[model samples]
Target: MNKLIGKKKITMENAFYLLKRIGFYKALKNIWNHNFEKSFLNKRFEQMISIEEKKGKEEKNEKLLIDLCECYLSLNNRFSSEILSICVPCLLKVGLKKDETDETQKEVEMTLLALSEIGYWEMKRGLYLNEIEAIIRYHHEHHNLSRLAYQSAWQFLIFRIYKDYSLEDVIVNELHFGREAARELKELRESVDWKRKEERGKEAKEVIVIWRWINAIDNYLTWCALWSEELVGFLGSIVQVFREVKDNHREVIYKCIYSLKNAAESRVIKVEELLKNEAVDVVLEEIHQPKLYDKMTYECLLFFLHISERLKEKEYFESDDKVRKTSKRVIFEKIEEEGYEDIISSFLETFDSLNIKLYPYLSLKISDYFVNV
Candidate 1:
């Protein structure tokens, strides 16, 4: 370490050679750990930041910059605010390199991903809201980049709404982070079409990233939440969540509740939106998911009750094959799993005890089907 820096400057050629010899991944990890990989060395993240601060701009090797960008992303959310105060700006500067070689383009690709990571972490915890927004916007209107940026922006907005602050502190009345100084988020929002950007990936993990932050919204932030069709579209994309995750799992259940609550509370997730998106069927199916059946008591009940309550004056089931099939399926599977007599007794017992008066809902219809069929 001393030998590399004792000469005071690392030439681009030495930088590239040293990086390749030591290996890109090793160098990236060591840059953060302040020691070669396998040695488990010292000075750690701060040492990496210092090295990048001094040489990141001067180093002409785009690959090195790419490695550093990756290093930055890796370190995000792993450390404290002190890290963000240093790392975020440094990586953004590296991302600005424009040598235009194929290597540099790859460097820029990883660099954009790193920037997205930084933006995402910062926004999730409600720090550097404006700076993170700028990093996201720097990716411009490209679908993938804009999608990530929007998702990060959405996270920041959720925290901002939930905490009721933009998180910018005013200094001596010079005002930073004040809503006035921040960019016009609402107007800026209108430009990026979220639904147009949400395409699927070959893998579920890849596809789920598009909806990761979308699941975080509720009534406190209604702009994107109000897009009931889009929200439900995201919900349908991950119908696997309802079926796969353990019944009472907090993360999946919370996301489901928040999506429903976002629509219900925002007054935009209408029945047509639910039905068109297959969201109703998804909810109906969830009642039969053994794991969720126990974990999502309120969400499961509220979803059906609310939907049923909403439909009471509107259609009264309206003779839809889909509705009948879904209700019948829910009843059959549930009875098969937990004996017909017990299934009927448990639900009706709960409904009677809850003292609910609502009629003309899915639950009652399901109950009636069990009694007759």
Candidate 2:
């Protein structure tokens, strides 16, 4: 088993399956339980790192590292924090070399994948905020990390950190994180040839990273709106991506519209900005689609609700009531002309089937707007 693990011949799942077939699974679990008590695995990790530092060699033992990663995955979560404390520094020190030997690069990639899994585990349990901070700090300080590493770090921030930390703790306090992420998003948007299938396949890793950033923005829209100078450009990029990939990538369109919906709810982005970016047309077109899932339909409806609320605020508060009213009138006409009434009716008719609890209220709000418009 050790030979196979060191040789990367067996996966964690395969190892477990083999153990069960041989009826050693329970015995191995007992062994692991004992090791967990003694912190044996953690000590092994520390010993490996200590030996590496003492040797002072540029080439890493890739097979040993792969074996260690497998061992890390097999262990329970009891010593996760300790393991992460050891693994995080190792990952940073390795630093994802681009101009290194294949063996060294493989070692770095394996180390990163191991640390990412550990970090994700900690994030899911809402433990080890300090260690999470360390990873984020390392990513910020070391700009030369690979895209896979960047994606993992951002996903931890955008998806998991919010479980324990607030938007203010991470997004607001760490303002540069948002800006750097926006810059990365812009560069990714420009670099991709969205029209070419071959290009997308070639840049699949980057495309995944781009979606992670979009999701981060969607998750923290209020902060992005208040802090990101590129919020308008972010919205424009989403709409543009939606227009380019609307047919084949409905999921991407959903995320884009959801981000726009979040932008509307933030109340930081102007309705005119949305209109200028064709966000209104995008939502209308989605809602008018012949078949949309309930959640997608709900996002489209909520988008209109928020947009109308913004327009209503302008109608009441703006110094030029005539201009505000005319703007609101034109938008309402656009919605009405786009047959939003039918969309609302369709949603109401299928309200019982929708998974969203707020669907009925949202439907009525938009319905009232159309009736009064």
Candidate 3:
């Protein structure tokens, strides 16, 4: 039904041309009953690859191929390892060929997800180390796969690299490259709310299947941003994206703020201004109002405190005496006035654990105040 060659167009035969595609939910349920048996999994992979080979010639087959991948994913995990092993390389082969088939991107996402699942399963089975070095080498060689698959591949790759290499080795050999990958993530973050977001949000939009690929991109990019220090270079952009989302969706914005906090604490960035500015104020406002529907207020506060503590210790922006002074004053006052112990305690705890040093004056003042009050 599909005739695709290289990176061209999708030509569908009359038999499959006017297809009324089944819904993902229905397909998901249907695949589950198949038990992921060998014959069914092999047949599915063969059909998927056959279609992908023919799909580069036309774009329509892209949607069908993506659907097939999802259906295969929803099937039992029995076939996941083998299916993924074949699919991962196949997707790389197709995606790296300079083709523009939406199907190719779709397949790339399927492959990344499959690999992630495989990696997770392997880790659980404690069989990860045997293949981890090979996986890292493969990822390093095919780093271009970063663009084709879900952005989460970056994290998968980083996790793999971390598993294979020691901390000192990562700091020496892979750190720079890891930071570069994190920069690529920043680009993806900046594009999320572009005008395309609204168009992409439209339910009737035809590229619905391809949209999954986009989401995977976002997740992967966010993961990279979460795991690397290169993010510190884009503090302004991260704040801007957080503000954009915060203005529209408070809850999601808070979560993003927390993510930024975790990333910053991981030494991904130096984001004092972001946490010290209106974003922190927003968190304070939410804390005061106390919405039961969304209980992430405490989590956001913890994230804020963690990053703030990190910055204080690292002294990345020592010149911002105002932010530093204000944060200490706020925490001291909060602890003193309401007996809300978490404010200073969380900061102190994270600071001690990370071995980050705070300003001598600020530290002395807080200690003295606590000693007296």
* Candidate of highest lDDT: 2
What lDDT does each candidate get? 0.42, 0.58, 0.41
The digit string of per-residue lDDT tens for model 1 on 1-373 reads 3345446477544643444434333322223432232332113435555565566456744444345435544434343455555555545554455455666555544444444433223334433445545544444433333333344333433444334343322210222221311122222223333334332333322223323443433422354322222234444433444434323334644565546534443344555555555555555555555554433544555565555454443344434656545544554454465454443345654554333443333354443324122
> Cα RMSD (Å) between model 2 and the true structure?
8.6
Model 3 clash pairs are 4-54, 9-57, 9-58, 10-57, 10-58, 10-59, 151-220, 152-220
Q: Output the better candidate (1/2) by lDDT.
A: 2
TM-score order, best first, reads 2, 3, 1
Off by over 4 Å in 1: 1-43, 50-69, 72-78, 93-205, 210-258, 265-278, 289-293, 296-299, 302-373
Error of 3 at 313 (Å): 8.1
Candidate 2 lDDT over residue span 1-373, tens digit each: 6457457789745764453333222222223343442564346554664454345346776444444443454343344455445445445455434445666654444444334433224433334345445655665775545655565555545544444445444544563554566567667767777777544343765666666567767766744434444456677777777777676656667778888898777755666677778888888888888888778877877787776666667544323666556667678788778878776876675555553554455644335435244
After TM-score superposition, what is the CA distance of residue 55 in candidate 2 from its true location, in Å? Answer: 17
TM-score of 1: 0.44
The residue-by-residue lDDT of candidate 3 on 142-199, one tens digit each, is: 5534342433344344444333434334422453443443354455554455333343
* Candidate topping TM-score: 2
